[model samples]
Target: MLATALSASIAGVDGVPVRVEVDVAFGLPGLTIVGLAGSAVLEARERVRAAVRNSEFAVPDRRITVNLAPADLPKEGTGHDLAIGIAILVASGQLDGERLPGTALIGELALDGGLRPVPGILALVAAARAAGARSIIVPAGNAPEAAATNGVAVHAADSLRAVVRHLAGVEPLVEVGPPGPLRGEHQARLDAPDLASVVGQRVARRVLEIAVAGRHNLAMSGPPGVGKTLLARAVAGLLPRLEDDEADEVRRIHSVAGLGARPIGSMQRPFRAPHHTISTQALVGGGPRVRPGEASLAHRGALLLDETLQFRTDALDALRGPLDSGCVTIARVDGVRAIPARFMLVAAYNPCPCGWAGVDGHVCGCEDGARRRYQARLSGPMRDRLDLHVPLAPVVSGLRGRRESSAEVARRIGVAWELQRRRQGGANSALGADALDARLGFEPRLLALLERRGRQLGLSLRRLHRAARVARTIADLEGSSEVSRDHLDEALLHRPKDAAA
Candidate 1:
C-alpha cells in the first residue's frame, strides 16, 4: 500500500511545502527515507518508529520506503516526524490517509509517543494555508502561535496516541480558534526607556527625535560618559508600534530564528544591539544554517552598534548594502535568499583610541597615527551611508536641561511621520533623488548655499542627496512644505566629520 501526507519546512524566513510519501510493501522488514533529507530529518525515522510502537500501534514486518516529494526540495528538522508516522500508518492499512486531503501534519515525536513543539510552526502553518491546507495538526505547545495565522483551522494534539485516536474516529481533536486581530495603527504600544531619564545634552535629544521621526541613520560621536547609547535606546520606543502586516512579517522571522518561545507581543518592534566583538558572519547572518543576522532581525526597527569603532571593519562594512537597499541577500550553496532589513541604524563611537580626541578642556593622549588608525575603522562608504552625524559634549553636572518626556517627544515625532507619509508615502529619509526634487525642492538661495557648502565639504553625490533628505526631514518637523536655508544649514552641521577632525 502507498499513502501520502502533507508537511512543511522553513526556508529562510518562509515555509516550504513537502509531501511525505510512504510505501509499505511485502518484502523484508526495513525502512528507508529519501528526498534530500537533512541529518535532522533522517533522524526522525527512529523517533517515528518508537512513537508508533509506544502508542500501542502494530508494526507490520514489511519493506518501508519514505519519499519526501517534489524530491527537488531539501527537507530538514523533526517537523516531518508526525507526518512520516501518519503516512506509514496509512500505508500499513491502519488509517485512511485520503480522508485528510487538505490537512497538514507538523510536529516532532518523542519516544514516549508525545508530540513536541518545533520552531517555525507559524511559518509552516502559513505555507500549509497557502498550499490549500484547510486544517493543520500541530503540537499543543505550538498551537498558540499556529492559531495566530489566519485562513486555517488548527488541531492541537498532545501525543501520537491522541492523534491516532482522533484520525481513527474514536475521539475528535479540538480545533484552536484564531487569535484576536493584531493591533491597528495609531496606537503607541512600545515598551522602551523613557527619554526624560536622559538629562542634559539637549542637542543629542533633538537629533534623536529627528532620527526616529524620519527613520534616518544616525552616527553619534562623543566621549564615553555622554548619552549616545541612551539616546539610541530611546529611539526604539519613540518609533510607533509595528503595523499589522509588519508585525506578521516580523513574527515569521522570529519564528525561524527559534525565538517563538519568547514573550514577544504582537505590536512590539525589535531593537537589536550586537556587541562589538560579533563576527562578520553573525552580524550579516550566515553560518551552517544561514539564519538572519542582526540587520535582518532589526527589520522595521533599529540596530544600535555602541562603541561603533570597536567593531571589526569588515563586520561594520557588511551593513552598507542592507542599509542602502533595506534588505540583505545571502547567497548560500543551497540557493539565494533575501531577508528584510529595513531598519534605522544608530552607531555611536568615541573620537579616538584614547576617547578624548574631541572633548572640550581635555588633552588627547593617543599619538596622531594611532588616532588616525582607530578612526579609519569607519570606512568612507559606511560613513556616507549614515546620514545624521552629531558630535556630543560631555554632560554638564547640576545643569540638567528642561527635558521633555518620551511621550511628549514621541507625539511630535508621530505627527511629523504622519505628515511625511501623507505627503510622500514614506519617511523623509527614504525619499529618492527624483522624489526629493519633486516634493521638497530648495529655494534658489538655499540651493546655492548648499552647493557652495558641498564644494567645501568635497561631498559626493550620495552625500549631497543624503543631506537633502535630512533637510527635508528638518523642514517636515517644522511643518514647512519647502526646504529653507536654515534647514540646509542644520543638515550640513549634522554631516559626518573627517577622521582627523
Candidate 2:
C-alpha cells in the first residue's frame, strides 16, 4: 500500500513544499527513507517507528520506503517527522489517507509521540497555503506563529495520538484563530533607554534622528567614553514599530532563524548588535544550511556594530554588497539565494587603536603606524557606504544643552517619515538617482552648490546622491518646502572624514 501526505521545509527564509510518499511492502521489515534527506530527516525513521509504537499503533513488519517528493529537492530538519509518520501509518493500513489531501502536517514528533514546535512555522504555513493546502496541522505551541498566516485553517495538535484521532474522525482538534496585532509602534511598546538619560553627545543624538528617520546608514567615531554605545542603544527607543507587511516579513525571517518568539523587545524593531568576533558567515548569511545572518535578521530594523574597527576585515568587507543592494545575495553550490537585509547600519568605533588619538587631555598610546593600520580596517568603500559619519568627544562636564526625551525626538521623526512616505512612498535614503531630481523640492542654488561642492571634494556620484538624500531628510525635519543651502551644507559636513583625518 502507498500513502501520501503534504509537508514543507524552510529554504532561504521561505518554505519549500514537499510531498511525503510512504510505501509499505510485504517483504522485509526494514524502513528506508530516500529523496535527498539530511541527517535529521534520515534520523526521523527511528523517531517515527518509536512514535508509532508509542502512540499505540502497530509499525508494519514489512519493508517500508519513504520518498520526499519532488525528489530532486533537498530536505532538511525534523519538521518532516510528523508527515512521514502519518504517511507510514496510512500505508500500513492503520488509518485512512483520504483526509491527507488539501491538508498539510508540520511538526517534529518526539519519541513519545508528542509534537514539538518547529521553527519557521510562519513561512512553512504560508508555503502550505500557497501550495494549495486548505489547512495545516502544527504543534500546539506554535499556534500563534501558524495563525499569523492567512487563508488557511490552522489546527494545533499536541500529541501523535491527538493527530491520529483527529484524522480518524474520533476526536477533532479545534482550529486556531489568527494572532493579534503586533505590539504598538515605537516608544509606546519598547522600554528602551531614554534619550533624555544620555548626558551628552548631542551631535550623535541629532545624527541618530536623521539616520532613523530616513533609515540611513550612520557611522560614529570617537574616544571610548563619548556615549557612542548609549546613543546607538537609544536608537531602539527612537524607532517606530515595523509596518504590518514589514513586521510579517521580518517575523518570517527571524522565525526561520529560530527567533520568532524571542521577546516583546523585538516587537518594536530588531536591534542586532553583533560582537567584533562574529564570523563572516555569521555576519552576512551563509553556513552549512545557508541561514539568515545578522544583516537579514536586522531586516526592517537596525544592525549596529559597536566596535566597528575590531571586526574582521573580511567580515566588514562582506557587508559592502548587502549595503549596496539592500540584501545579502549569497551564491552557494546548491543555488543562489537573496536574503532581505534592508536595514539601518549603525557603527561606533574609536578614532584610533588607542581611542584617544585626537581627544584632549589624553596622550595617544599607540604608534602612528599601528593607528594607521587600525584605521585601514574600515575600508574606503565601506566608509563611502555610510551616509553619516559623526565624530564624537567626551563631555566630562554636566549637561549644558536641553536633553529632549526619546518621545519628543521620535514624534518629529515620525512626522518626517510620514512626509517622506507621502512624497516618495519611502524614506529619503531609499530615493533613487532619478528621484534625486524628482519632486523633492530642491532649490536651484542648492542643487548648484551640491554639484559644485561634490566636484570640488571629489565625491563619487554615490556620495553625492547620499548627501542629497540626507539634505532632503534634513529639509523634511524642518518642514521646509525645499532643500536649502544650509541643509545641503550640513548634509555634506556629515560625510565621513578621511582615514588620515
Candidate 3:
C-alpha cells in the first residue's frame, strides 16, 4: 500500500512545501528515507517508529520506503516526523488516506508520541496557505503562530494518538481560532534609555537624530564613558516603529532563529548588538547548515557595533556587501541562500589606541604611528559607507543640560518618516539615484553647492548622491518641500570621511 502526507521545509525566511510518500510492501522489515534527508531528518525514522509503537499501534513487519518529493531539495529538521508517522499508519491500513488530501502536517514526534513544537511554524503556515492546503495540523504549542494565517483553517493536535483519532473521524482535534483582526500598531512602551540621561554631547545627539530620520549609518568616535554606547541605544529608541509589513518580516526572522514566542504583531524595531569576539561565520552566517547572521536578524532595524575597531577586520568588511545590497547571500555547496539585511548600521569606536587622541581631559599617550594604525582598522571603503559621523566630546559639569526625551524625538522622527513614505513610497535611505533626481529636485543654488563640495571633498559619485539623499531627509524633517543649501551643508558635515580623516 502507498500513502502520502504533506509537510514543509524552511529556506531562509520562507517555507518550501515537501510531499512525504510512504510505501509498505511484503519484503525485508526495514525503513528507508530518501530525498536528500539531513542527518537529523534521517534520524526521524527511529523517532516515528518508536512513536507509533508507544501510541499502541502495530509496527507493520513489511519493508517501508519513505520518499520526500522534490528529491533534489535538501530537507532538514525533525518537522517531518509526524507526517512520516502518519503516512506509515495509512500505508499500513491503520488509518484512512482520504482525510490526508488537502491537508498539511508539521510537528516533531517524541518517542512517547507527544507532538513537539518545531521552528519556523509561521513560515510553514505561510507555505501551507500558498500551497492551497485546506487545513494544516500543527503542534498545540505552535497553534497560535500557525493560526496567524488568515485564509486557512489550523488544527491543533497534542499527540500522535490525537492526530490519528482526528483523521480517523473518531474525535476531531480542536480547531484553532483565526488570528485577531490586524491589531493596531504595536506601540513601543519600553522606556528606551533617554537621551536626557546622557551627560553631554549635544552635537552627537543632533547628528543621531538626523541619522535616525534618514535611516543613515552612523559612527561615533570618543573616549570611553562619553555616552557613545548610550547614545547609540537611544538612537535606536528614537526611530519610528516598524510598519505592518516590516514587523511581519522582522517577526519571521526572529521565529526562524528560534527566539521564543514573539508577539503576534510588534512595532519595536530589532536592535542587534553582537560581541566583538563573535566568529566570522556567526557574524556573517554560514555553518554546516546556513542560518541567518546578525545582519539578517537586524533586517529593517538597527545593527549596533559597539567597540567597532576591536572586531575582526574581515567580519567588519563583510558587512559592506549587505549594507549596500540590503541582502546577504551565503554560498553553500548546495546553493546560495539570500537573507534580507536591510538595516541601519551604527558603530562606536575610540579615537585612538589609548582612546584619548582628541579628548581635552585625557593625555595623548599613544604615538602618532600607533594612532594611525589603530584608526586604520576601519578601512576607507567601510568608512565611506557611513552617512553620519559624530565625534562625542568628553562630558563636563557645565555640559550637562536639559535634553529632549525619546518620546519627543520619536514623534519628530515619525513625522519625518511619514513625510518620506508619502513622497517616495519608501524610506529616504532606500531611495535610488533616479528617485532622488525625480522626487528631490534640489534648488539651483543647492545643486551648485553640492557639485562644488563634491569636487572639493573628492567625494565619489555614490557618496555625493548619498549626501543628497540625507539632505532631502533633513528637509523632510523641517516640513520643507525643497532641499536647500543649508541642508546640503549640514549633511556634508555628518559624512564619515569628514570626521575620520
Residue-level error in angstroms, candidate 1, position 6: 0.6
Off by over 4 Å in 1: 182-191, 261-265, 397-401, 441-449
For model 2 the local lDDT of residue 204 reads 79
Model 3 scores a C-alpha lDDT of 0.85
- Stretches of model 2 off by over 4 angstroms after superposition: 182-185, 188-191, 261-266, 396-402
Encode model 3's per-residue lDDT on 1-501: one tens digit a residue.
999999999877778999999999999899999999999999998999999999999889999999998899899888999999999999999999889998999999999999999988888888877887889999998988778777889999989999999999999988899665345532544655887677767788888888999899999988988899998888667767677778778777777777633454544788889999987778867677677889988888899999999999889999999989998888877788888899999999998878888777669999988888788888888887888888887766645557778778788888999998887788888888767553475766677788899999999888888899899989988999988878888999887773347
Candidate 3 stretches greater than 4 Å from native: 181-186, 189-191, 260-264, 397-401, 498-500
Worst 10 residues of 3 by lDDT: 180-189
What are the TM-scores, per candidate, against the unseen true structure? 0.95, 0.97, 0.96
How high a TM-score does candidate 3 get? 0.96
Top candidate on TM-score is 2
Candidates ranked by TM-score: 2, 3, 1
lDDT of each: 0.84, 0.88, 0.85
Measured by lDDT, the strongest candidate is 2
Q: What is the lDDT of residue 123 in candidate 1?
A: 84
For every model shown, the clashing-pair count is: 0, 1, 0
